[model samples]
Target: MERDAVIVAGFGYRRGASASSLHAALALAQAGHAQVTALAAPGDKIALLARVAETLGLPLFAVPLSALGATTTSTQSPASLAARGTGSVAEAAALAAAGAGARLLAVRHISPDRMATCAIAEGPDR
Candidate 1:
């Protein structure tokens, strides 16, 4: 059987980000988009991201800092750059976790509280 294409949602957030913050950011990123197949974030943030993944029943990917640095993103945030060495942590995480040949479907979207950010990417058949 042919494998299905995958859509990955990646996140970046403050230290105290709550599940609500993540869900809000995800909602914005998911607007007018297909359902996400997985979730991703920096390895350090994986613990925080786990709640959202568990709620959504999706797999989560812990992208390494090296991989995040290697991926290019559409948006640039000074905070993200200074802290993570990436233009946009949400975008970089999405691209990195989406695997080779993955392309972004949506740029980063911040939560209403500005405590979290999310981006979406679509990858080749899994």
Candidate 2:
């Protein structure tokens, strides 16, 4: 039997919040292909994720920056991460999950906001 895949994209509402997760969870939910989503930087990613989760009535803990994928192309700076509500999103995710009494799942931040969706769909180690 074949198994579906998961695609985590960078944080963004490009595809609209209502459909983002659905599109992200697509592959496995219906077609049994892959579950995908857009991941983003720490500062904005956390709130963005939380907002999205809230809108979807899902509990979201933390969203990390490093987990977001390589940031060499990103304009975000180390200082920026610190300034953002989410510094060290990886650790924050742990903390958030702990506080929310939820099990934290590791996720990667996709990229840009446009085609980055396709990048994350490629999976990690890209």
Candidate 3:
């Protein structure tokens, strides 16, 4: 069987959030996907992103705030807009990191603790 294309998981979280929160958000976002090629988030969240990446064993990509503005997301959040000038940071980061021709495979999903959110975007087939 042919392997599936890479999926990028984008995350957003509050400062001092735990790695387990990120892991839960990622697991919920991934659904049934066997693996994720990368993890992405805003530049300021590098520390948390790095932790999540290390836990998942995936490469990490930091999405700039400028690039995030142009991303079209399936959902909108006032809090994200107020903080990042975008409706959904997770969606925007996933789309931005996935590069051109990317589309969201999963919309933003918040963790049980509500400390983190995650979304998945599929890049063009390799």
lDDT (Cα, tens digit) per residue for candidate 1, span 63-83:
999998899999998889999
Report how far residue 98 has shifted in candidate 2, in Å: 22
Model 3: per-residue Cα lDDT over 1-126, one tens digit each: 675666899888888678888888988998976467989999988797797688767899999989888888888898998888888899999988988999898999898889999999988644
Q: Lowest summed lDDT over 10 consecutive residues: which window, candidate 2?
A: 112-121
Clashing pairs in 3: none
**Ordered list by TM-score, greatest first:** 1, 3, 2
lDDT tens digits by residue: candidate 2, 1-126: 553332333333332433454235322222332333333224444554555545555433344444333222223336436543333333233323232322223332333232112112223321
Candidate 2 deviant stretches above 4 angstroms: 12-44, 56-63, 67-120, 124-126
Which stretches of candidate 1 lie above 4 Å from their native place?
none
lDDT of 3: 0.86
Per-model TM-score, in order, reads 0.97, 0.30, 0.91
| Top candidate by lDDT | 1
Task: Please give the CA lDDT of all the candidate structures.
Answer: 0.94, 0.34, 0.86
Q: What's the CA error at residue 9 for candidate 1, in Å? A: 0.3
Please give the TM-score that candidate 3 achieves against the real structure: 0.91
